[model samples]
Target: MTALDTEVAQSVGDIRESYLAQVGRRRLYSGLALLIFVVLMVSGFNIADERNAGGFWEGLHQIGDYPGEVLTEAWQKRADLPGLISEFFPALVETVNIAAVSTIIGAVGGLILSLLGTRGLAKWPRLIPLFRRVSDILRAVPEIVIALVLIFILGGGPVPAMIAIALHTAGALAKMFSEVAENADLKPVQGLASTGATWTQRMMLGVLPQVAPNYVSYTLLRFEINIRASAILGFVGAGGLGYELRNAMAWGPGRFDEAAAIFILLFSTIVFFDQVSSRYRNRLTEGQAQ
Candidate 1:
């Protein structure tokens, strides 16, 4: 080959080798990361199993035992199932109400927090970080922790659960609402501002109109989540279907029928809400896209 051709060929070969080496290094790093993740997962599972009240292997086969007993008892007392459900219907209504009220209050609080935290939308730009930190702290606290503490002070009732769920919902929704607000078209806000509109007016007329669909969708999903949370809080003396379930469970074998009724009610309610929320969310998103 000519000298020039030979030089070019050498350069090309070196480039190809370097590229291959880089690719090999990337693959090696990726494999190492995957290995570490697997190790951590296995170790975490083993640790959790060790600390559990029943060993994983020992309880694995018996996982169906409780459900089986419940089902058998429920079948034997099938005639009483409707009566049991009716008796606990009030508790179910309380759970629903708690979720509903909490969602409404939380959504409103979150709307304010999101507006205050978002850049370009904040009524007080200097307080954005403070608002964000407050939201983070709220989201970090568990609903059960808040519920139990409130119950101690207020006595057992649905109010504590409602407030606990609302606080958590507000914090959780604030981050999401702020993200949506950040992407909102600023033209409307600017136009409104030129008309001597206040921050509240601009937000309500300009920003909220644009983000309402997504906000409502998120609120509905949160409502579904709050229902389950309220029920759980009830188990800790907050008072709801969970309280009824706890009472039934404490009665042992004879009360399996009652437990089964509560389980069916809870499961049915969850599924119903999930389906309704999913349908509405789909419609909202589709409408927004249009």
Candidate 2:
């Protein structure tokens, strides 16, 4: 073959080698990542098992025992289930109320945070990082931890749960809302600004209208989450259906019926709100599509 042909063949060989090397590197990186993930999972499980009182495997096998006992007793006393449910209805209401109030307050806080943290809509653009960091910090702490801290200071009640959920919700929603805000058209905001609108006025009149549906949609979703959070907080003395359920469970055996009643109430309420929120979210999405 000619020298030209040999050079061309060498170039082709070089390209093939380069391609193989790239592929090999990618595979190596991927394999390393997977191995690291598996190691972390195994080690984490071992640590947790070591820390557990009953041993993870042993406890896992018995997980259903308590639930089965509770259900059997509850079924035996099914005749009185209606009365028990009625007795705990007010506690159920309180739990729902806690969720609702928290969602509203959190939505408002998230709205402000979103607008302030977003690039295009921030009133104080220089402080965007500060706002974003604040959002992160708020979201990092779990609602239960916040509730416990507040409970220590304020005593156990719905207020602690509400405030705890609201703070976490604000941070969670802010992150979501900022993403939506980032895509919003800037023309309306500019128009408002030209007319000497204040920062709040500009956001309220220009940005809010565009993002309101998504904001409401997120708020509704957060409300559902907060309901569960509120109940769990009640277990720590936040005073709701969860508190009643905890007391019933603590009584053991004889009180399983009451625990079952509270469980049913909490489950039914969650399902009902889930359906309602889903329906409304669909409506909002359809309206936006139109």
Candidate 3:
């Protein structure tokens, strides 16, 4: 065959391969869609089954029958909105306290771990395996499990929750901080070392400055998460809005309304924090850009 004919055949073969790849991609997407639909269908059936399992119809009827009473009680409390919020405010404050303390404690621990975590600062390559293994072990433990254990040991209050959050946060941020350290520009740290800067001096002027914004950013994010976590810890007897929520739910009738109010407060708190944190993050990003 002529060289021109050979080239045409090769071009046609390439086009055919591309067409097959596109067709395979479409089938893959279709299969994924089908899998998602099946999962939704199964989940729906399970929910329906649970709803109908007991004398659920009667329970629904009871709620429906007394809808007016529920509304009336909730409405009556409108005049006491300030009092209720005030009562719940302490728990909210406790949650904030827990979150703040946890973040601070976690960041300090992470900072210490980061020194070893940073590959650039690492002296012995043999130490890398030990640090990696330790970090891996730390990250493997979930915050919730830590809370459960602390609940058993400490037996109650925001202390257990705070410790739980701090431990997990330390574990998590240590890994992230280490990665940041490993990837950091080593020039400044190395140069500082070459100039006879003490380890602390080098970290303060060189490494710390480079990673400060990121470390602070992560700490802020952890505080936000800790707020939500403090709520769950409340279920296990940690003092927070979650405690109020638990009491309300368990106390029956008018209590759910109180719990719902607390939920509103908690959600608003989160929204406020989110706005503040987002603004700070944006400012930091802008500063970096400039």
lDDT top scorer: 1
lDDT per residue for candidate 3 within 50-108, as digits (tens), equals: 87756555466676544555456667777776678888888899988988898899788
lDDT of each: 0.95, 0.94, 0.79
Ranking by lDDT: 1, 2, 3
Error of 2 at 8 (Å): 3.1
* The 10-residue segment with the lowest total lDDT in model 3: 63-72
Model 2 whole-model lDDT (C-alpha atoms) = 0.94
Candidate number with the higher lDDT (1 or 3): 1
User: TM-score per candidate, in order?
Assistant: 0.97, 0.92, 0.81
Can you give the lDDT of residue 95 in candidate 2? 98
| Predicted structure with the largest TM-score when compared to the true one | 1
Candidates in order: C-alpha RMSD to true structure: 1.1, 1.9, 4.0
From the highest TM-score down, the ranking of the candidates is 1, 2, 3
lDDT of 3: 0.79
Q: What digit string (tens of lDDT, one per residue) describes model 2 on residues 17-79?
A: 999999999999999999999999999999988988889777888989999999999999999
State the weakest 10-residue window (summed lDDT) of model 2.
Answer: 52-61
| Cα error, candidate 2, residue 32 (Å) | 2.0
